[model samples]
Target: MKPIVVTGGTGSLGRRVVRELLDAGREVVVLSRRARPVADGSRFVSVDLRTGDGLDQALTGVDTVVHCASTLTGGDEQAARTLIDAAKRAGVTHLVYISIVGIDRIPLPYYRTKLAVERQLEASGLGYTILRATQFHELVQHIFSLLGRSPIVPVPTMRFQPVDTRDVAGRLAELALGEPAGRVPDFGGPEVRDAKSLARAYLTATGRRRLLVPVRVPGRIMAGFRRGENLVGDRFDGEWTFEQFLAEHATRRPSRFTDAGGSGG
Candidate 1:
């Protein structure tokens, strides 16, 4: 099998996917925007998806490319289009894209970009597999940690199904190694919890005290989350829960948390 190239291999999900592929004894190449160290047996190549620089060289001998590179900021569509073009020219046999669940139903900026990327992959002539998953536990933790700083945490009255990044990475690795399937079943967490409940759980796990203010956020995106548009009803495929994830990573809590909202990914 030709080596698999993982875009954004330094990111939370991409890094985990790279590790999984290497563990399976498959030749893996880590593609990133900047130079970074990778797993002992894996290769690393600096590739900027924004400009397509180094992308062609990175994909030269790569038969499969797992696209985990995404940004909460803009330019995701351009990046996806550029990647599809480069992958086609590089003779890639299969392209696996990791996407977010409910991007079609949600109207958030990030979701819009992800949805557009999905369409681009669908229209691309190259063989592709698109796997959409719920938000990761780490993302939720970041959001909560941000809000936890204040005396009263204002949590939007929304719902979430936070899956583990490791689980998503495993699925991506499997898809990278398998035949391309257009779009598979959406992956979700074991249980769906409201934002307030998740916030309380996080505070309790991290040994913090804060009044959680559940406010009705007025927006189509929040409305979509309230309507369970971000949830997968029949596909509760992940094993890790929010509580377990908190317990496992509680020791790495930052002394100061940022005051930013959670990302839509």
Candidate 2:
């Protein structure tokens, strides 16, 4: 089996992909800005994509490149260019890109960058598969944390179909092993839940009591989320619900209570 190169292998999804690939008996090389040990017999190489530093060394002799590295604020195009050039130079057979669902519909800065990366991959002339997935379950937790403590969890009035990161990783590994097929079907969570409902579920599982207040933000990005722009196709397939995810982690900790008089804690 050819060695598979995984960018951002230290990240949540990237690490899972590396594990799946290695479990299938494929050689794995992790490319990141820092060297870190992984569990699946994968080797690590330090390469900063922002400065295009050490990319050549990472790409050398790599068979399939699964690009999981991305910037949320800026520099997406430059990073894509560097990775594509290095892959082409190294004669990489396939380039598998992991992207977010509904990037085109969302007006957020991160989503815009994701869309640009997708275009670059399509035009790169390398056999590629762009797998667009819905928000991960962990992402929702992060969002809730960022919102801070509040009596009422003010969720964006939108629908979400959050998938588990492991399922997305499995799909990416399978795509890497097969031929590139351009943009594949969108991968989404098993069920659709409103943002406020999901937040309430998180609170309940965590033993935190809070009211869910759905609000509409005055912006294109919020509008898109409200319209379910981040959702996958109607026919998309996956099996992981927010409830199941909450149940898995509910018993791990005690629930913290906060007053509704101020922001959530």
Candidate 3:
């Protein structure tokens, strides 16, 4: 069997997906723009998705491609287009993509680009599976950390169903192992929670005491969040809860916060 190529294999979710595939005893190739240390189970292939530099070569003889790479500085569409072209030339069997839930309802520019990428992937004629997930627990904690910079943290009057990245990785690995299924059921956390409560929980977990000021952020994005656009109440596909996630990361990030990404999931 040919190897599975994973774009952004060094990224937060991509790395986890690589681990899952490796544990499943599948050959994995981790593609990155620059060289990264790879002494583990997977092979590292340096390739650029934007300029198409080395992308075609790395994708050679690959059966599946799990596209986990995303751009915050823009050029996401270009990278996806470049990758699709390369995958077609390589005769890749399946292309799995990760997306966010309720991107269509939210009017954020980043969300718009994500939706556009989903459509582009669908029309690419490649066997593709799209997994739309909710906000990540790490990302939510990161937001609270930023808001908690001052003595009074302004908590948004919104709700979010944040899933664990580990769970998302497992789901993506399962989808990659299976045949193409377009836009599978949206994945979310076990509970749908308001931001204020989550913020308090985060503060307590991080051992910080700050006045949580519940502020109503007026905007289409906030309105969408308030309406739980970032949530999938019908089904909760994730196994880890926000509290469990916090427990694991309680020591990792005690003072500072790192963004999972600009967008959720």
Candidate 4:
């Protein structure tokens, strides 16, 4: 197998994908904005997609490129374009993209950018596979941690199917090892969970007593989430569940408040 370059290889999903590929005895190169310490025989190349810096060298002699870098704040489209152009010039064989589920239905800013990126890849004349996955367990936990900090946690009345990052990484590595299949089926979590329910579960697991206040956020984005656009009901392909993820990591983030305090701060 030729060398595989993973963009954003320092990120949560990208790192896992790189690890999986390396574990399978594949030559792996990680593309990041800054120099990072890499062991286990993996190569690290400094590249900035935002500025198109170091991309040509990063993609050099690379057969496949797994694009896992995304900016929730902005510039996702530009980055995609930069990568597509660079990969084409490098004679890359396969280009794999990581996208979010419900990007077509949701009206969120980040989702819109992702949809744009997908279009660019399709029209770029590159052999590509776009794997749209639901939210990661760690991302969901981060949101809950911020909201659960207050006594009366304000949770959007939205449903989420948070899949494990490790599972998503495995799927990505598998895709990279095969032929490009264009846009594949959506990958989701084992079960569907609402914000309030998940928040309560998190509170209980972390020993926090916070009153979850369900907030009905109006607008197309929230409406889409409420309508289960973020959930792939029948496509629950992920093996890991939210509860299992919590069991493994929840202990590390124990609440500062104990049972003696009714509403945690």
Candidate 5:
């Protein structure tokens, strides 16, 4: 069988997806801008998603692609277009994409770009699946660490559901292995928590103490978060909780967190 190519395979979520795919005994390829040593069972191919350099050659003989690659800056739609075109030429069957929840409700530029990419993939005429997941546990931890640096941590007066990357990875791996399912059910964390509460949890978990202050910024972006547009209500697919995640990690580092793809949420 042909390999399933995973973009941004070195990222936090991408790495786990690659591992999950490998564990399922599927041939895998890691496509990135730079050549890196991937897992033993998978091969890494250097390709620039921006300029489309080396993408065609790497995608040859590939039938499925898990697009964990993304950017907060501009150019995501262009990159997806390049990949879509290349996938079409390669005769790729399924293109699995990871996206964040609430892109439709959020007015953030990055979210708009993600939404655009989704539409692009849907129109690409290739079989595709899009998985929109809540923010990752590591990302939440990273946010807290940044805020907790000072004695008083002023967190945004908003709420979120933090899902574990492994859970999302396992689901993505399963999707990659199966037939394409367009826009499957949203994956979310076990509970919905406010940013202030999450900050407190981070302080408690990391053995740090800080005064939590909730700051309500006036903006559409903040409004979107406050409205819980980013959260998945009642339906939780993640098995792990935020508290469980903090217990497993002795130290939470920004390097361990990723905003790449929708996993950066």
Candidate 6:
């Protein structure tokens, strides 16, 4: 098999995908804004997706391209255009793009960008597969950090079926090696969970006694989450549950208030 090129190879999901490909005995080339240190046999190339700098070199002799690079919170269409144009120039055979579930139904800027990119891929006349995945376990951690120090964990009233990044990576690698099938079934975690409950569990794991506050966000974006727009289709399957993931990496730490001696600083 010709080498597989992974855009954003230095990112969280991109790195996992590259590792999976390499483990399967396929040569992996990582494309990023800067060259990074590689494992003994892995390869890395510096390429800026924004300006299309060094993209042609990154795609040369690469038969499969796994587009894992993305701008957080949105900016999908521009990224897709840069990659597709370079892939066409390089004569790449397969293009596999990773997208979020419910992008079409959600009104978030990020989701809107993703939906636009999907449309572009469909009309690009390239052999392409778009794999939509639910939120990752790390998303909870991100939420906690974003909320900062509060007496309670305030979460939007939303349902989620988060999946493990590792599982998503494996599936993407398989798709990159196989034929393109357009939009595939969405992948989600093994069980459904509410934001408040998940937040409570996270607090408990950290030995905190904060209340889990469910907030109803206003507007179409919030409505989308309330309707569980980020869930997978019935045909898709995943192996990890939120509890299972927590058990594997749970750590006990004092609450922020306790750390600051109950001062509301």
TM-score of each: 0.93, 0.91, 0.93, 0.93, 0.92, 0.90
List candidate 4 segments past 4 Å from native: 251-265
Clashing residue pairs in candidate 6 are: none
Q: lDDT tens string, model 4, 7-100?
A: 8898888899999999889999998886766647889988889888889988888889999988677888989989999999999979999999
User: In model 3, which residue pairs have backbone atoms overlapping below 3 Å?
Assistant: none
Clashes of each: 0, 5, 0, 0, 1, 0
Tens-digit lDDT track for model 1 on 1-265?
Answer: 7899999998889989999999898999998887777778889998888899878888988789999988777788888888989998999989999888899998988898888899998899889999999989999999988888787789988889999998899999998889999999999999888887888778778777666667898988888988999889788899989999998886444434432334321
User: Of 1 and 2, which scores higher on lDDT?
Assistant: 1
The better candidate by TM-score, 3 or 6, is 3
What TM-score would you give candidate 4 relative to the actual structure?
Answer: 0.93
Candidate 6 wrong stretches, greater than 4 Å? 73-75, 233-236, 248-251, 255-265
Off by over 4 Å in 1: 251-265
User: Which of candidates 5 and 6 is the stronger one according to lDDT?
Assistant: 5
The alpha-carbon deviation from the true structure for residue 144 of candidate 6, after best TM-score superposition, in angstroms, is 2.6
Q: What C-alpha lDDT values do all the predictions have?
A: 0.87, 0.82, 0.87, 0.87, 0.87, 0.80
Cα error, residue 67 of model 2, in Å, equals 0.6
Give one digit per residue, the lDDT tens place, for model 6 in 1-265.
Answer: 6899988888878888989989899999998876776544568988878789889988899888999888775555777898999999999988999999998998888888888888999999889999999988888656764553577556788887878888899999989879988998888877787776677666666677665556788998888888888887474467877777777776776765432222111
C-alpha root-mean-square deviation, each candidate: 4.5, 3.3, 5.0, 3.1, 5.9, 4.2
Assess candidate 2 and give its lDDT: 0.82
Query: For model 6, what is the error of residue 38's alpha carbon versus the real structure, in angstroms, after optimal superposition?
Result: 3.9
